[model samples]
Target: MNWKNIEGLDGVESPGLLVDSDKIQQNIDRMIEIVGGAEHVDRLFPHVKTHKMPEVTRMQVDAGITKFKAATLSEAQMAAGAGASEVLIAHQLVGPKLDRLATLIEDFPNTKFAVLTDDPQAADAINEKCGDADSPLDVYIDIDCGMHRTGIPLGARSDALRAHIDSLSGLNFAGLHVYDGHLHDPDLQQRTDKVKEILGKVALHEKEHPSPRIIVGGSPTFGIWAAETSWHLSPGTTLLWDFGYGDAHPDLPMTIAAALISRVISKPGEGKICIDLGHKSIAAEMPLEKRFQFPDLPDAQPIGQSEEHLVLQTANAASLHVGDIVIAIPRHICPTVALHSHATVVSGGRVTGDRWQVTARDR
Candidate 1:
């Protein structure tokens, strides 16, 4: 839980999040350049939900990032308190959290607040809340491009949503928010085409409602979106690259800056070595179940995971002793990051600092 000036503990701690500030900066710069700098795009709203460290967000803002995308209202508050002028609550602000959103808006009047809503009821709630606050809230209509998880259907309903925002007393109609979460295909052309189709639909609908501030793309599709024209990218994982998306996109400079560094806590069987971290440390939902690479045993399978141990079946488990530290590259970065409270940053194999107060530790 400690997160401050761990400038000399690299060769000491068993295992923890290790951030290469160099690679982190490289990733940010690459994203900025790819997006054609701050002047060209409306605003580069980098999502802080991935790393969740205020220091990392500060770094992005230092590099000319003004807008931020946060999944939860807590994340939005965290980012805004950290000096982010504008924040997009990318998730629905439902139920009784309207007051919290209002508090965030009232406290940080300088910070422009926006929320995405597919349901008109939720939109009505948001509109009512903003009206009570007597503040103009920016609202983006979530488009169901490919990811059917959340977003409204992309059609005349989009027009209806736009009209609803315009009718609201204190809401500004921002453009569209389309995230193609299903386009994680390894095939380059297939992924590109899927995104193209989604954005093409948005473009078609945009003819009727030319609001002009469309937010799209994630860490996986940032490059693909950049290759196209007139689209802004919201890359959260670019700050702390993971085993899942980073394996395919090597052009991204960030690496496994955060890791579950555990010891060989137990040796239960012949060819299986169990580490201290499991679903509790790094969430079990990985990109690929059988795809895990142990530096000690390159051919190891990160097969099954329990609450507190990772079962690694390998041919050379004898090489791993009971006290030796082992690093685990989590399959999915977001939830894996949520497991830890802070990261032990390293540079040139020396511990530089501890980024504490991991902001995105909860739902």
Candidate 2:
């Protein structure tokens, strides 16, 4: 889309962020279509941690999605209050976080809130909380299946954990959470094999436990899990059209829907130009120090970036004099998006003048 020449955008802005709302909706639709056809699954409870925008979350809810997996307590409460019927705190809710969880549960009594934990102490804590409130708190046991980030190793100990949760009164073992973020490699065949192997183990454990009502599959493994089980696949980033997550599959439909639109601030050296956006604007987690791309100026490439300046490699650097607008696609979309407060909505070459707030800016 030629964003610069947009109708409502002509006199309003320069050096701003832009989001293709159509593209985002399309991405969400495509993901739903992919997971919707699962053999006998109830529904895909998409993870809302990716795009923390309440508007985007409502878009999912309006599409008949009632369940969601949140990475944080705030995400769960925010999403549930907005419209989510069931919100899963996909991470272990421990320490002082439990107090907030208790309060949110009190606030949203109709909403289903669940948390994941491998430790029995958390189960005891949940029991205490429930005892205090005189109600039950839904819970899930995190099973470590290859990915060593969280969860207890799936085996004898896992079986014991399930039994322990079953014996508890205030805590209910909702299901299992297996996330294989490592499987998001470029090699499609290898990734598929890994997913199959990991899921196979989870299926076995589920059979033995036969207690959890919801089996939460991690993000990258959503497609496989949707195919294998009748549970929800927590696919979050699938909504935001991130370049970094889908880097493995070059043919994936989700493209970089958001870009950091900046302007040439200076012509510092030979064959180089500095842009207004820098690490402050783009994601610092990007693999490279810089990334430059422009359909209009395809030859230009990113070389490096400073705190406030981005240096691009281009032969026709002189063509992009001071104040020339340049749009940069960040390697990662999540953090990059949080860097901006509003996005300049555009269509084709005309600006739509729609501004979207970065709702997930808080740490």
Give TM per candidate. 0.90, 0.89
User: lDDT of model 2 at residue 35?
Assistant: 72
lDDT of 2 by residue, 224-254 (tens): 6666666657777777755566565653456
lDDT of 2 at 270: 90
Worst 10 residues of 1 by lDDT: 1-10
Task: Supply candidate 2's per-residue lDDT for 151.
Answer: 86
lDDT of each: 0.75, 0.71
Model 1 per-residue lDDT tens digits across residues 260-346: 566788788999888776677775564436334444456777757777777778787888789776666666777777777777776
Off by over 4 Å in 1: 1-15, 38-42, 132-134, 250-254, 287-292
Error of 2 at 35 (Å): 1.8
